[model samples]
Target: MSDTPQIHGRVEPGFEALREVFTTNFTDRGDIGASLAIYVDGRPVMDLWGGQADPGTGRPWTEDTVALVYSATKGVTATLVNRLVEQGTLDLLAPVADYWPDFGKAGKEHVTVTQLLSHQAGLPVPAEPLTRQELIDGTPVLDVLCRQSPLWEPGTAHGYHALTFGWLVGELVRRATGSTLGALVREQIADPLGLSLWIGLPQDRNSSVAPLINGRPDPAALDSITDPEVKQLALQVVAAVSDPDSLLSRTLSTNGALPTPEASTWNDERIWAAEQPAANGITNARALARMYAACVGEVDGVRLLSEDAVSTARAEQVQGPDEVTIGESRFGIGYQLPTHAAPLLGEGSFGHAGAGGALGFGNVTSRVGFGYVQNQLGASLIGEPRTAALIDALGGVLA
Candidate 1:
């Protein structure tokens, strides 16, 4: 068990010290499977993954293996939004209602692209308990959201869009590009660039996708919060999760699978098959890093996001209180900021972390794209063990 895996890659000789850091967290564990890849100044530097793809079957994880990144998919979604802006097809400051007319409901006629991308638009959980079928079905859920009221004045405050964030933003892309975000991503970003990332995971590729495992060993005790009003809302959230029919529960249930309280969401073959871009991006470290590298540099002469687009992508937008998702997340236009909310490659770096420890992001500061994906979900608000350790290792290399 002490013998760490010999996963392939070419890490610089001096940087080989990171192999121990990588092994430390990925140490032999039947329930865990992951992969990590780093590209610095537009070149592949480190790539590794270990543990089992599925403990019951004894399948070993490999370079090509992909895992559901949960929220980490947000950074990628943000990238696509920036790409559209680059082509002048979409405007960041323009009102969202320009593309989707019904989105102007509840005094939200002025909500702009920046507001939605930065999660300041005030739509976290839907006002209605949307069914899981309603969500994976796509059109129905979006219809509810379009006609729903804003939780607050759009630009006055900021909130995180927990589950519906992707669709809220993805729909804008659909209206602007005449293609679903997943379709545009595959045709314009993933396929042309040869990156293994997928927004709408294909059924044929299901075999290589890793399964998620709850590893919080310790979880938050809501009982300690003590405030009557706050406790009430928390309890409601708890009840919604325990109630399998609740929208939050059903939206994540996915093809007969039950939703767990700690895990943000699950990707059954169906969830993956749908184009839920803001979350449910199932790809491995190799794939995530390779795709992000395109944003950081040219890959075979193809750039997914222009240098200006990358700059715009990394620009910080919401930094104080994130009304919708976690209490406070430092967010850029569409990507998670390198602030305390989501720690990553380092300050000035931008990326996203999924529920639990699954994380992925790229660094415009160092011209690097780094990604780490794991099936073992961590309990932390931002991410898990791999995040801190991976960033530390990357910091050493960048230093």
Candidate 2:
């Protein structure tokens, strides 16, 4: 790699710092291939990308390269739900059982749609693991979730729902609107905004998506932790995640259904064809940013949410120690707030970060929409240095 990575895209004059930060990511921070885009006041201010999309094949990341952004899909999913709410087809505070009666059983009778979207329904992991086929089929996953008891009382606590969130939201949407989440997204959001984003990726677009490169840290690296207690806890968390039967592992694996949740499973086109709204979304950073930009303001005559909807979605729905994440976290309607997992943008920014470093968010305070996607995975829950640097640069530019 050169001293300065050859970044391809334009940055508004005063925003030159963004290019410097983006270049440093490849030269200094091991960013393989990624793209970062930002929109301000409903206009594009920056659009940039660089590096090899596939290291093995030496495929260059291009202006149109799309990456599978794991959890960042949640931000888009939440946006879809919020759209329904705006249309009065779905109510955030309405009991979920009002739409899907099956969800009311097993102590979830009182759970509201907002609680499910905010990760407060305690359905992070189901009682039984669902097979990949079941996940693809969709109905089985919904049946299992409806019958299982929540780990805690609904609305009392918050935890990252992970895999279960998709089915919960998708089922509600299907019951309420009689359309799949993917169809709704294309019809309402993507078509209006002219974005290339997809929940259930179309067959023709598969060739443009860069394969994910999983990032796993060496276990020996843990020995460097100075605090004994912190080291032990970290190891314990790692152990739970590695164990096939553990809640974290099972939920991620869909009960040992996926061959490997992190990398291989997603490479399979079948996964892409299915609509796992919580994950498996594919899009370029520009589309992600534009989607978020439309959330808070107009983008090309399209506004996804009203000001009232934006305010409602960004309001703090749950905050405190998360049962699943095992740390202090915060969430709005369906988006992660500026919490430990993704403390980027600004005070009132809300978005979702993927398993690796992919993130998308809109800041109502600054009226800034930001999106980032990378094939090179990172090991931080908050974000790797590359994303942190770009966000810091953005903050400086805004300041």
Candidate 3:
């Protein structure tokens, strides 16, 4: 009923400044609707949300409002796979083709699970265009992916697999667990922890999600990259993204009719209901933060992973210029390592950022888990300044 954005939720005594950062996001940073949550030493220290859930309908953002956290979903998916590794069912160093022989075709025989998880498999996009229906079903897309050739030799270079990461990781999960990534996540992580996150969202829960509003990057968005070689690559990627016939466009816009990279695919119900581990998972800051918290330590008597598993998953597998984004990338298995895009966490923090500003991460050494979700999208390589500010504010408390 109120026209003005109202901040709602609790912040423990030590984390008071986080509340100020959340409020400033609405008042000064143009945040339309967002939530920020943090867990430290196995308990929640902050849980907050404000602004409108749907700007078009003027629906207020609430404690229950969830949103599609594009690539941040990777952190969850990675946890699913890493669990298999911990159980010794899947070996990180083993060839991916060993588990799924079909994946070995077309010069991909030696691609290891580590290479796939670390984004060094050089399969950033599919060899051919696919439809949303294929993405929803996933089997047909997996068939195509198995038979496709790597755009580059495995391990020689690394690039963000983007859309392909879900299929690659999902198929590996199915081979190891006899269950889909979504099903495993629910049974092993979400259900035990009682977290409100979904890899494959149920149709009935659709209305609970906030609608995503797309944003455009300014023409000079890439001007901040100072490295000359990386800058040149960034310009090339930007140009390819704009050209519909380029690999970047064809890969991003599986449906040729839709605009590449900027398509409103996540806004579609079909996307939300499907399991795309690299791109589509519906959740809020609380679920994300709590899930990450469980990864590193006990949260309410539940710990999703052992300390050794967490160490292996967060250990930096690769760091260098990414062939796709033409930006410096750091990856540890399926999680994005601390880099310029998400450098606010401590030295060893690891998590994933969505295409927009959404981010979810946990610092192992610091015993901190943080999650931020926003519907108003921004095209920042690392994360939105608003989310970064919250991370900065968090540091003062942790210090």
Which has the greatest TM-score?
2
| Candidate 1 local lDDT, 1-399, one digit each (tens) | 445555555576666866667777766332367787887777778888777787678888876788888888887788788888998999998999999888888877899988888877877656565567677878877887777788788878876675668889889998888899888878877787677888998888999888787765434546555677556655665675567655455444431232432443564687888888777787888767777888878767778887788788777786774443323567778888876535676675877877666666777778788888888776532335566776787788778
**lDDT (CA) for every model shown?**
0.73, 0.85, 0.83
Over 162-216, each residue of candidate 3 has an lDDT whose tens digit, in order, gives 7889988988888877898999999988999888899989999999999888775
Residue 98, candidate 2: C-alpha displacement in angstroms: 0.9
Task: Please provide, for model 2 over 1-399, each residue's C-alpha lDDT reduced to its tens digit, 9 standing for 90 to 100.
Answer: 445657999899899999888888888776889999999999999999998888788789999899899889999999999889989999988999999998999899999999999999989876876667888888888888999999999888888888889888988999999999989999998888888789999999988889988775644557666677556656666777768777667667777786333777778798888898998888879988999999989998899999999989989998887787665679999998896545787677989988778889999988899999998878643336677888989999998
Q: Estimate each model's TM-score.
A: 0.86, 0.94, 0.92
Q: Best by lDDT, which number? A: 2
Off by over 4 Å in 3: 1-4, 216-237, 245-247, 254-263, 381-383
lDDT of 1 at 370: 81
Q: Positional deviation of 390 in candidate 1, in angstroms?
A: 1.4
